[model samples]
Target: MEKVNYKGADLLAHRFEIRVIRHFNNAIEYNAVPFILTEIQKRSDDFFQFPLSNGLLGTTIVDSAVTVTINKNIAYEPRRYFTCAHELCHVLLDTEYIRSHPGIDTEDKNGLPSSKNSSRERRANHFAALVLLPDTILNALMMEKKSKSYIRHQQKVSYETLKYRISDFIQLRFLLSRSMALDIASAFADKDADPLQQKGIYGFWHAAEDENISPLSRQQIAQKNNDLALGLIDPMVFEGCK
Candidate 1:
């Protein structure tokens, strides 16, 4: 939650964003996650990792790859997605500036970067947020479906879902539904009903319970993402992060 040095982070974010844009040339409509990895591969093999531990929280490595374990036996989709993207930020944006830079403690059994001076891990996290929530796409989608119903809406969305995409994500599912939006509306319609589960939209929004903003959490992740670049972190990252 510290104030992020966005000005510096924006410089790096913009630089890399342009790199991705140039690589895509005119095909810039694809997902940024895969695209960033593609570009990283051209220069190195550090974006992807394997042998992830079952209870893994997070890790930042010298190369681009960061290994985070969600669950080996079951699927925890949201956390997995978040971790990979966070690690991606570390790989792409963190830079080493000699005297002014953080040093790697390779001899310390692989914590190369000492997590000080300039925190590469933090930078990567910022990059991950930008990649996952690219402004151009998220804003347009939210604005487009600003009036659609969440529950009644049944359609295949490439990046988001009718299930709990950002709309239901923030509890506006009723206003955005095509028909079945009332499935959960009645649950809350009683006026006595708890606002905990607004249809199936409950899970995603509370995916990170340690810190909740009801509606702003949706937008805050992106904003804090920029904040992390400035050396700040959303509570989730700061809460239990090493």
Candidate 2:
């Protein structure tokens, strides 16, 4: 991974995300995804539904109504949750900026700011990840049950499909890519376990053949997330995310 030093602004943005999560009481105490979404909406004065292009995920209009809208094109639950949370960040942190630029659509087509100067979008994405999957919550969940046991109870798929399913679960739960999730699984799974039976902990999934993590794979994961990624509040928020 390229070693891009995190500038002071980036660190401050990260700290801001941490504070936002705290303001919402960590968003995980309710132990329900729907509850988080409900809380977010309750904070808003009004919400709208709009059909947005595939590339564009959402928009927020902060006027007298404090309105927010997300693209209807995002069909999946995980992406929908992330997009909503992203806009909520704007509602919570960027209200002044939005109010000044009323009726202006922050056209973030790729989940980042439209321009290099738009640092708020970066911070919003970071805030969304924290709201959706706080490290503290995941760690506490893991402490209550063995990883393998949880997997076995949560799924009934054949051993052949379990590995991929686990990968999906990790990606959805932690807001990570498949490659990053696999790398995490490779580190968390027990090497001694049978390939088909291995299972991972909170932030990882069981590894299948050729899915093992090596130094090169680790670098790839970091690069995919951007070597200096800000999709997290705490640097150690998710193990193996770096």
Candidate 3:
């Protein structure tokens, strides 16, 4: 996945990203239904769960008080949980948009970015993914050598989400060597242990070539990796989340 440019909604999501993670004690995954319920209750907001059309996931209505409604028809627990988180993003971050729109913001089955969705929908999706799978926790998992299957099961996220999240970080954010990135991504993705090795000599030569990463950046990455291994880095700290 290519790097998404930061937008107004992205900035708003970032503000609460660490807070949401800390609220869950940096757990890889938890029951988002209860978490979101607690959040809405804390704000004196209303929450409802009802059977809805299969194509609809959830909706957030901002009127006298914010009300979030989820479709009980969502069979997959993970998807249901994710929908709750996505709606929570709107309750917390879309105040201005809600005021202007003055109606219910409906979320369809396709919660992620799409031509049919609005920017606010995309922002909500971004917030849910960021809070659920933070960079710090993901890095810690990598340092602990956790497998992709384990992460997917533990994090309650789909394989596609895990792959894209790790790929985006390794390829764009961390700027790791191509072979190394493939190794890390594949390890998490539960693919071949070493996909590059299957390609033989060219793969070996490509892996050998320097990526020309700056010495300072390399040193910083090394330090952070070490800290993650040692469990010294605080996951609560924002550290300019990418």
What TM-score would every model get versus the actual structure? Answer: 0.40, 0.49, 0.63
What are the lDDT figures for the candidates, one per model? 0.37, 0.50, 0.57
Model 1 Cα lDDT, one tens digit per residue, 1-242 = 22335456546555655565554433224245555445455533444444445334344444333322222322444334545554445444442222233232111112122344335444544455555444444334333322223212211122223222343323332222332333332332333543333322233222323245346654675553233322211223333231
Q: TM-score for model 1?
A: 0.40
- Candidate 3 on 82-199: residue-level lDDT in tens? 7877777777767556766754367767654332336667667766766556666666665444556667677776655565566556655554555555544444454543323222
Model 3 scores what on Cα lDDT? 0.57
Better of 1 and 3 by TM-score: 3
lDDT of 3 at 208: 23
lDDT of 2 at 123: 63
- Report the C-alpha lDDT of model 2 over 99-197, residue by residue, as the tens digit: 876643454555655534356666666556554444444444344434443433332212222343334445654446777666444443434443222
Candidate 1 versus truth, CA RMSD in Å, comes to 14.6
- Number of the candidate with higher TM-score, 1 or 2: 2
Model 3 CA deviation exceeding 4 Å by range: 1-34, 102-104, 112-117, 176-242
- List the lowest-lDDT window of 10 residues for candidate 1: 104-113
In angstroms, the error of model 1 at 48 is 3.9
User: Which lDDT value does model 3 have at 28?
Assistant: 53
